[model samples]
Target: MSAREPSYFAKCACGKFCAELYGEPFLMGGANCYCNDCVAACYYCDDKARKEGKTNISMRCADYQGAGAAISCWLLDNLRITSGKDQLRGFKMSAKSPLCRTYTACCCTPMIYIGQKFAPRWRAFNLNCVTRASDGQPLKPTEMSNVMGDFALKEAWDQIPAGQPKYKMIPWGLFPKVLAVIFLPFLFPGSTVKVLEEDRAVPGMFIDAAMVTEVVSAETYVAAGVRVPKALLEDKKGK
Candidate 1:
């Protein structure tokens, strides 16, 4: 089957610049990020550039699809540059990183990073330079790793719903097993098959309605530094 397509539009702060997206809206699942590089880039370079008399710190680009020739043509022809080409600057990181090819010249803003990498047959319009209102909300990461571990927080993942049309969804019931099978190897040091098997047997017992009372009691007991079962608690409280 052909891969899914996602697209988005971005604009600069001035409202004078805008770009269109034509490919998969997200490059990776849940904002896959390389923490060391991204953190250094954002804090030392991007943040510094902004502090140095940079009013329009935002950069914007649109994701698109189609052949490379067509995509390049579209970007050059259609991308409306509303302001400060002189301020633009492109920075290159690893020669292997996809940004190497895309971040050719930082003519408009030095801090703004733009580059292309082989991604699910899609493109990412770096959002750092977006200055227009139409640039849409900040680019929510599709996958995030390391950093503040904010991405690991359950609340962060809650923003997206299950079974959204644009993306595939894993059933909540299957999540633990799926995660164990897929990620446990990388997360844990040893063989994951056994761990995954064990995990699958438990299979999110905390969320099971049948175990809610027990789970709640365990939580309360733990909070109180006591060991009491829900049944015992109920009995003692005459509930």
Candidate 2:
């Protein structure tokens, strides 16, 4: 229901590791990443985990923020790891961005990509590690700044339900039209517009995958409220 409710649980591959949601989910939509370091890190991590016998690992979320506000919460300092600690590994990429560290501990599965930047209050957790009864369908990509690969965003748009409302208020289908009319000029050019897409390989990173469509420029299309087919988007070329 609401993001305030306890709706998600993170677990490792062995099902021994778990984390509870205590905050609203932040940045719960698609992102495009272009950073080379981000791409290298994700590839290395995923490859290493696969070799370690961890496959099909992912995070889970209770609700899609694209449909509502992100769940926000303070990290539970006393949370327990039920298993797979011996294989857990952590890496710190940038010192300026956030105190966040990516982890693959507990069965060599990519666990949480948490940070303290939104700290003293909110923390963003990777949705893939969360557990729930739902199929994790309409899977929303939260961040995309770290992706170095290509991706298809149109496919993701197709997954979102059409009848829903924007921000849980305005009618969903008409939301784009409203934005298009309101920001027509900015949608054209002579403006600093950046289009983003989600890199499935990296959690919480957005890369620039705005070239997947031809209907209109990414900026104009986004401003006009047209949903791009995720199938048209492609993740980075390799792994």
Q: lDDT at 207 for candidate 1?
A: 16
Model 1 spans with C-alpha error above 4 angstroms? 1-7, 22-24, 27-34, 57-88, 94-98, 101-114, 127-239
Model 2 poorest ten-residue lDDT run: 60-69
Error of 2 at 16 (Å): 1.8
Over 1-239, each residue of candidate 1 has an lDDT whose tens digit, in order, gives: 97322244444344343445444333232222222233223323323445554444322111111001101111222233333333233333332233421221222222323322222122334445322234455545454222122312233223333553121232244346544544545677574222223222221111112221211222333332223334544655674
lDDT for each residue of candidate 2 in 132-202, tens digit (9 for 90 to 100): 32553433444322121232133323344565222323224444653563364456655422223322222
Cα lDDT, all candidates:
0.31, 0.36
Q: What is the overall TM-score of model 2 with all chains considered together?
A: 0.40
